[model samples]
Target: MKLHLKAALAAMLCTTMLAAAPLRADNEPAKAATKDTAAMAATAAKAPKSIDDANAWVVVGDVKGFIQKVGEVIGKVRPGTDTSQATTFLGVMLGNPTIGDLPAGSGVAMLILPNGDNIAFAELPEPKAEANAKPAGFALPSTRAEGLTIFGKTQASADAGKALAADVKAKLLGGKRTSSLHVTVPFGRILKEHDKDIRDGIADYIENVMKIQEAGRKMGQPPSVTTATARMLEGEFRVFHKLVSRIKTVEFDLDLTPDGIRTEALFIPEKPVAPKAAPGGQPTVSDAIKLISGQGAMRMAMEFNPEAITTFMEGDLMAVLTEMGLTKDDLGTALKWMKDWNACFGGAAAFDMFTPGSKAFGGQMIVRLRNPETALKMLESMPEMFKASGLTKLYEDMGAPVTIEFKKNAREIKGIPVHELRFNVQAGNVPNQLAASMKMWASGVYQIAAVDNWLLYLVGEGSMEEFIDAVKAKSNPGTAPLAAEKIFGAGGYFYTDYNIGAAMKMMQPALPDDPANAAAKAALQAMSDAMASAPPLLAAAFNDGGRHKVDVIVPLGFLEAVAAGAMKAAAAGNAKMDKAPATTSSATREKSPADQCAENLSKIDGAKEQWALDTSQKFGAEAKWDSLIGDDKYLKRMPVCPDGGVYTIGKVGEPPTCSIGKEKGHALKK
Candidate 1:
């Protein structure tokens, strides 16, 4: 009933016992993977929004007054390098995006601190105002911080101790103080600098990551973008604001206190957003997709299908594994993903990478950089622990291997980078099943940062078959390979159904497009991309770890099954070729009567006998060379013996040239 993707997948397998669809016999038809299909386009135009998103919190008008009181208490929480506040803020925002409605021309409140940490609150632009800020989930003021303890400060006595005179030292404890207080180092700096307490604070950041990591496991781990925001009131008109441009993770602990809504957020350091390309000649979606997923070699068969993909998640997922060639044991320590993945990717850009040779695999650092480059570079540089590791080796050592090919797909939306991408991912066979079962392998949009490259791609066998179908359907080529293949052929990583869900979540509150809302519309459009899942057949191959070429796309299972069938077919065929003739030629030879009579005739006629002997000798010598080697070499000069052998000798020191020896061969003694 819950549009869970896991359950729906059971009904739609990429491969089956359905009668094999025949290929077109006509001229080779060009296939195009355009996102122009009416069905797919509609879904992209209106991807599904969250079930409760409509009623979620909307912070419109100025709620600065309310936030200030809250900030006072939150500030007392010295979350120095701690992620608890980050998670709490992320969870609250995720549970609800609207925090009271407001009219136009207003801004969120903000402030900065000496330590570069701050709080931010919202006050929507003026004109429209709505009250009843129905804060949902565990309301902030109602709940308290989890495991909060008494925090105390230590007195600094180092400077005072040093400033004492020799006489005072003798009176106090017989120790001399030579330095003046002004010249001596300030004691407070030492107390705070690298203090055991300061390092201890890092636990907060760790705990936050752990919390969000747990939440990600609960949610789907789609590409979710997280920002650490400390919402608090600053002065009257403004709310102090500080946020990580990108958060790599998030989770909420509502059970500890059962009442406390504790959230953890792990944010990526903010960097300048990429500059978008200037407006150029506009292109159609098909053309853009074509440019991105060109030829079978490099094509970007993109679509934005949410409903079709959501059908895959259903039932208790362990049942799904029986079909996918996995067992309960495969899940390892992460038996419950509903709670973990939900929290991980239930936000902006929930990202999971299936790259070959990158550190993104292996450990669970979950580094969600501002952009893909930062994430890539971090892994690229982390191998310094070894004697030597360059970018190439780093890629080789990763859990999931990846090689990306970029193509210009979409026009830069308001000068932001929107390139199409295809990653040569080395994933297992039938990845969708694994995605449902394997926590480590599954990736959602929540962890994702903006992908600069890799729009269209191909992976393992027969993947391109599905893309070819989508392209052919949209482009409506005269010929198509197979109806099944047409729907899902080419394989590579594209947005998952859950990912589309996340995409729609971020794309929520689609602004009304009008003359006055031109800027807002631009912002909305800039953030949105019309993406869809690659056909199931194609998607399965990359997941299946099989080879895929355009029309020839095949799932690993399909290929293996076909190979076994072919081997049987070939074995049957070999039995038919073994029935040929054994030999050839039908001629006979007779001995001359004169030869038979020669023995007796030799006594009577010497001259005639001598002539016959000379003729026989000449005939035998000429036939000897032709009978043995067919051709003569220098070794042919050797004399022939009566014994059916010819003898030629060469020194052992000199390389003995090949020659037929004139002797009955006998086994040589070792």
Candidate 2:
């Protein structure tokens, strides 16, 4: 065996031992054992002899059964598709020495004491002589032999796990012996037990790794890229750690059904945390869900804890800005702007996407707000804030210079004030194709409207009028809200529904029309048709008292359709490869005179655009060759036309032209 593999196995053994034993006190293993035993006895006495008595538990159901079901489903979905090899591979992998000893429907139960110590009990199959023998080069520590027990190797060990498995099946599995897997963790208890240690670790990282003390240096002296990045990471870690600490326990379950697999996760908090009340005490999450329920191919609604999120953002943003060499006073305006923007939003928001009779999709977001006026004011003052805070220069230093502009009250829809936000990115030192893509992305116009204490935002290739009209129709009384769907009957604080069939249908036209993709396209069409009547995939996260539950449902038909499509696509790809034509070598291809001229024209056009942006020149503004083409300018040197044609540097907005006529292919394509 390789050294790394041996080390990994040794580490796994150490972890298992540690889980079996209690945390030692000053190296006194005997005292730790005694204390742990007493604590466990007390806990067991207080609670009934049930799976809930354990701090955590993991249960895995019949593996062979699940594989068999999947194979059957695939065969029915696509008759010609072969899946025997895949199932055989899975069987061989699962039958390895490391885990092959474990019986089907095995489980582990863990009991964590208040002092952060834990003991685990696992059920195992009757050990086979060959499987029980440790692999060569893997060794266990003799000193911890007493802490590790191989269940089912002895009558006593076998008896120890029998009761545990019975309790788990009776209580946690609800007497259902189906093929499924489950894991539960008491996160809050663990965090509480090691609160001081966790906090100290975070502080140490911030001080040592982030070098936070250097943040107080004189303003305008930027920290090194490494230090700045470390500070940002520390900030994010702090926020995430805080969030996780609040979670009491997390439980995950995956169940195999006749149709497909279903997975669920539940997050329980130490205490209930509800969204802030919307203005006029309206129910924001539910109302928003109702408004966009049956309108689009995909829909989402969520409610947030505004106070907690705002606090996290304030700390994170301030730390990052200070690390970037900004003083407290310099950040005040930006911080205030952020706070005002945050205050304007209520805790709830809804979003949806739909195809608008074209190849592209469109989306709209509606957010409940306490005051739309405040949001409008914030938008109006954003440009000045960026300028005053030296953000433009900061971005330029970071190599992502951008121009931000806003047009307030650009238009009104149903008497609501609509605004437009635009961004222009000046990409530096990148391929022409990537630069063009960045330009297109930066050119997108984000439209927003203030609609009676609610904000409506529109995006994508659809017209603003079309988006607005669609939203209005969905909001009408006659339309059914998404919550009415049977799959979403159990409403949640966050809910999302995806109509996969509809989305695939919309995307079909965007697929390539070449012969290589013909088979794949046909398969996609068949899958979409088969799933047309299937229920949409639904995911919902809601708080049930102290527990937060997230449930996701994927219909069996959808899964079968996807499997069939993938198999067909794979076959098509193989067939294409078998008949593929000989490839052309790039070294053998020479550029024609016209092609060379066209390339030169492209370079000149890019340089001209960059120069215009740097000089704040508008459309039709005159551009000079000296300002654009030089060693120190946007271009290293003026590109010479191989066809010996003179180049014309046009105005700021127009493309550069070649004296060589279009008939000779010297001009830019499209």
Candidate 3:
């Protein structure tokens, strides 16, 4: 089984590499095809030779070439920018005094052995020594230790490097081989070997936290709150540890293909488990794909296993809710409703973001249902279930009173019963502008309708008519479905496509045209132009056989645009810094005794609040110095008064105070 698994894995890896190859037109010349084949062969030949008995390894090809490519892109975006200074700085830091000169096409690799030891080395060119060579301006210690050459700007660093290299017993790769990037991790082996240590580490951490909680309780924290918090943390950690132990191995590869750069990541399970058949049988065409339109700025489609999801919700989520002070009986109706809704789902859901006729950003969600009536029934029962779940009381306690109103059969859309759901929230202590914005958003007509067994939920600035028109267009035979796009043809459990240029263009007009934003606007335009010719960034996850695989393809143009934008921002910052006048050294300035005392009081108050939060103490809870100011507690150490006056840390939600009166500036300004 293991041998067959290896062969299958190898085939999968090769398929990903082949898929990254650029497509050629039918009429392309034979000579061009020959040249492409030769180039690909040469690239494959550069892959590093496999290490003996290696459990894992990572290889990077042409480190210096990648950096130079970025530099070139930056130069094109911002002319007259001096990248040489940056290059020279890197050379000084990574040159002779460290790992020697890293020239163009230099590759690096790290190999891990079965024993968990690893060694990292770079293919560095020999440093040049000349009479007039530029001085590094610092002395370096050079030594030959453990049959390896080591260099550091200081003796301490050199010693540290020697110590790190001491345990590496395997011979390093020394040949003309390279790759863009490759990484393999023996996750199962690592986890198995270090299982006890990991568990012990987490156990020790929880033990310490529990001790802190106990100390807080002794200092007047509520016993019930501390006990609930401890239970929640312990339960969460147990779930996390179980999830971590299930992995077998993970591999990631990023290769420079003829078209661009393609990255493939594989997550293998410890044991192969066949995927369960979809409920209500699989459709020839996914409902999500049918509903999505390729013209959107961003689109996502996913097929889910409701039974698996609900199992997790019922087990893990229910446990968490119980820890949060809710009984299973309290959540019984909601859980049952959720399970019924899941059962009604036809296994696919999709979301698309686009600019409707109104021109503002808008989005819609479409969920395919196998049983629309059951889904509708569960949806209608949601308000009652929520009311019975005690969630309203929780929200009220959090100062956000929420209300849910559902109007069923509110209207008819194309002979289909349309429903309106109004979810209102009154939030307290928020800024006026934010409150108004929230109100405007919450006041929108949240409409839901079942169109041909697909539940359509519309939001944002788009009108119901506009959304309906879009759905109709998918079946009009004139509009292209998102699945028609070449990128989406490779079917997967989950898929997403993003058009950066389109999204940026959508937001461009919203930006104000001011002198301060001139550079930003120019940079944005450059990025948009660069991405105009680039393909949409695509990501997809597939459960092939038993292993899960994810692939992300990024065109070179997209990377170049990112580099250019970063460079433009950096140049703008440099220009501003050059124009600004020099300022006095604030670090060397002294603070008044009163000011220091006030700062100390502020620190004490902050520590008290943190202590209270960790212990889940309500307002007016007392805090002790031992609980709030110890080395392992909230503050690293207790703050002292600059003057001979004492400080008092008041109860939770109250500020600390100094013996000096507020008239002397020894108190925080109200």
Best by TM-score: 3
Give each prediction's root-mean-square deviation over alpha carbons.
Answer: 36.8, 14.5, 15.1
Worst 10 residues of 1 by lDDT: 230-239
What is the model-wide C-alpha lDDT for candidate 1? Answer: 0.25
Q: lDDT at 274 for candidate 1?
A: 28
lDDT of 3: 0.59
**lDDT of predicted model 2:** 0.58
> Distance from true position, residue 233, model 2, in Å?
4.1
Candidate 1 Cα RMSD (Å): 36.8
Give per-residue CA lDDT, model 1, range 1-670, as digits (tens). 2122212221211111111211211232212334433343344223113211111111112222223323332333222222223323422332222323322223221111111111122222221123124245322211101111100010111121122222222332122221110011122322332233322323333333333333223333322211111001111102011121122222111111111111211122223232223135422223324221221211222222222223323332444445334565654333333222222221111112222222222110111122355334333332231213122233333223334443442334333433333334443432232323333322221111132222222232222333334333433232223222234343322322112212322332333322323444443333232222212122211222221112222233333333343444444434433332222111101323222222112212222222223222221112222222312422222332222332222211111112222132211110
**Each candidate structure's count of clashing pairs:** 157, 1, 1
**In model 1, what is the error at residue 432, expressed in angstroms?**
19
Worst 10 residues of 3 by lDDT: 16-25
TM-score of 2: 0.58
Model 3 spans > 4 angstroms off: 1-56, 61-107, 111-118, 122-178, 188-244, 255-262, 277-287, 293-297, 313-331, 354-362, 429-444, 463-489, 499-537, 553-670
Each prediction's TM-score against the native?
A: 0.18, 0.58, 0.59
lDDT of 3 by residue, 571-622 (tens): 7645654654453223312667786677677668667766765554545667
Cα deviation of 288 in candidate 3 (Å)?
Answer: 2.2
Q: What is the lDDT of every predicted structure here?
A: 0.25, 0.58, 0.59
